[model samples]
Target: MNDFTFLLPTKFVFGRGVTDRVGAELAAAGYRHALVIYGQGSVIRTGTLDRVLATLDAEGIEHTELGGVRPNPEVGLVREGVALARECGADLVLAVGGGSVIDTAKAVAVGVPYEGDVWDLFAKRAKIVAEGKLPVTCVLTIPAAGSESSASCVISNDELKLKRGLSSELHRPVVAFMDPELAFTLPAYQIAAGVTDMIAHIMERYFSSVGPVPVTDNIACGIIHALVEEAPRALADPRDYDAQANIMWASTLAHNDIAGVGRNAVAGGRAGGWECHGLEHELSAHHTGITHGAGLAVVFPAWMRYVWRSAPERFLSFGRSVFGIEPVDAEADGVDVTPEEAVADAVTATIDELQAFFVSMGMPRTLGELGVTADDIPALLETLEQNKGAVFGDLQPLTMDDARAIYESCL
Candidate 1:
């Protein structure tokens, strides 16, 4: 195991009616003014926004509202939020939706106290200090991206056609109110995509170049297995509280650095293990219509096919333990297959199993299905270079050529 330090300071309040406690928590924390952030109109349509507003009003807490945060949240909205929060003299930022909303709130929290432009933080020109950020809390209505308890926040610059993620301990929400009931109305596509996104979170950390970190690996595998089992149940009945609860908690654990502990993600000065996220960020950055999880669904399997040769042992172990694949023995089974062939078969089977699961969840299987073609690959590569540079990943560092081939293979 590598040397690492892990810290998760967010107080996660999870249960059936925990959304009702948002106002009381803030009141107890002595936050008098808040900037409430949310997405388009889901919360409003479902009456969740009204309930939250009522609680804040009843608690005598003043609040300003900012809405219309789209998927792959934009820096423009974040800028607006910062201005609004500053104008209202908000000491707290309350996000009332899922990852995008929470991420925008996080960006606003850091941006409100900064002297420079907020995009500079995403661009790595500025650094975020914990003391400079406002307190942030959330009512999670979605289970993907894990921004509620995560140290990372992603925002897209519409004018520049770039999407960037900034990670700082200051980005973690001070509190997360996760009520599974809030997710009961989500569309099937959203549920599946959310599940895929959480799975990818663990896979990125689980596939590391650093030697054995048995504890983190076990945690990662267990979360993935639970998600794999519960995702279908959630899809079949969105009101399945147990399934939603498991998935919500799993998403939190997936990206909050718990599964990534003891791993050097910055090895070689590259964002080593999160290879597919780098690729999908380019896809969603170029085409705003694509969801983050949907893009991952298409890119992850193709990436596995491209890189499995570099670390067959990782794939084989994942196959047997996670998917319950039986160990292959040449002599015991009286088979003619060589050891290399057996390993190859297991790895291929693992990849196939993952692809089949995505397909079962109604995820697109190819870039073509997402309306991305050979013509789009050049622009994708351009942004990929801008965001991720010439190389990324530590398990099998990928050059620009490798990325292009992976893109082509997906199509």
Candidate 2:
């Protein structure tokens, strides 16, 4: 068993219209001026931003709008926001959208204290360990990236197709205002992608060395159950509040370090192994890109096929418990499904179902479908190949060969 320790301090405020409480939460944090950070035009189209601004104004909070945070948020933007916050004397940050918004906000908060370019944090995070950051709060719109509660942010340096997560104990949001109703209008594909992301979170942690920690196992199982159970209901009817709430909580809980907490647990707890993340980051860097959720859809199954040999009974247990695919039947003298195949099939089925769900929801299902060409592949692979040797041993150790094979299979 690998040894470990854990600490998660993000305060979660959840419910329908719970986002309206951002003003109160920030007041409790003693912040008077803040910067409103969020993603593209959708937040405006949906009026989530308008409502958030109205609520903040009602609470008498002064703020500046730093709009135009993009998908695969750039380090340059984070640095720009830091400059904005400094010029305006903004003391706190309110991230009013999905994972990218929160991730971008976290990057800005950290950048405020740094003297150099923020890209330093993403490319080589060894410098500033932690400094005084403007406390951040989230009005999460997308549930896919658990970044609302996670302390890590994957920033892409636009000049290069390079992407890496800048992590520090300093980056977790002080508050995550997760209102399920806010997620009601989310497109069907986003809903599928969000649930897919949560399932990946659980699976990444579940593969930890099969220890006898009942709590960890139970938590992993519960997250898987909540995700698999609510995905269809949410997909069938986008505005189901109960299904939305169940999933919203599942997505947050998936990465809050509660599910896979135990000393020497199989999956790395303090820092979970993100084998698929390495593959998906480059996939997103290429083309208009697949949703992080959809990239995960391909990366995960292809990855399970790559790692099944490392842990057989664990994968078998996953198939049986999560997918309800039993390895053997009492009446069948016939050959039973092997754990490896069952787990792989279950994972692939999960991905394919998610892909079908993605198509139904107006999201891309394949890299080719996303317009990522063969020209993009070589540059993308080289981005991670150069870095894998440097960032080993979080969830699993990955060799360059392992990285290449996974990418080729994903293609």
- In model 2, pairs of residues that clash are 208-266, 208-267, 209-266, 273-395
Top candidate (TM-score): 1
The residue-level lDDT of candidate 2 at 383 comes to 79
Candidate 1 TM-score, true structure as reference:
0.97
Q: lDDT (0-100) at residue 381 of candidate 1?
A: 90
- 11-79 in candidate 2: lDDT tens per residue? 888887787777877777778898999888888998989988887788788999998988778777888
Name the lDDT value of residue 219 in candidate 2: 77
Could you tell me how far off, in angstroms, the CA of residue 219 lies in candidate 1 after the best superposition?
0.7
What do the candidate models score in CA lDDT, each in turn? Answer: 0.89, 0.74
List the lowest-lDDT window of 10 residues for candidate 2. Answer: 263-272
Q: Looking at candidate 2, what is the lDDT of residue 279?
A: 75
> After superposition, which runs of candidate 1 have C-alpha atoms over 4 Å from their true positions?
265-272
- Lowest summed lDDT across 10 adjacent residues in model 1 is found at 263-272
What does candidate 2 score in Cα RMSD to the true structure? Answer: 3.2
**120-235: candidate 1 lDDT, tens digit per residue:** 99999988877758989999999999999998899999899999998888788989999999999999999999999999998888777766577887888899989889999999
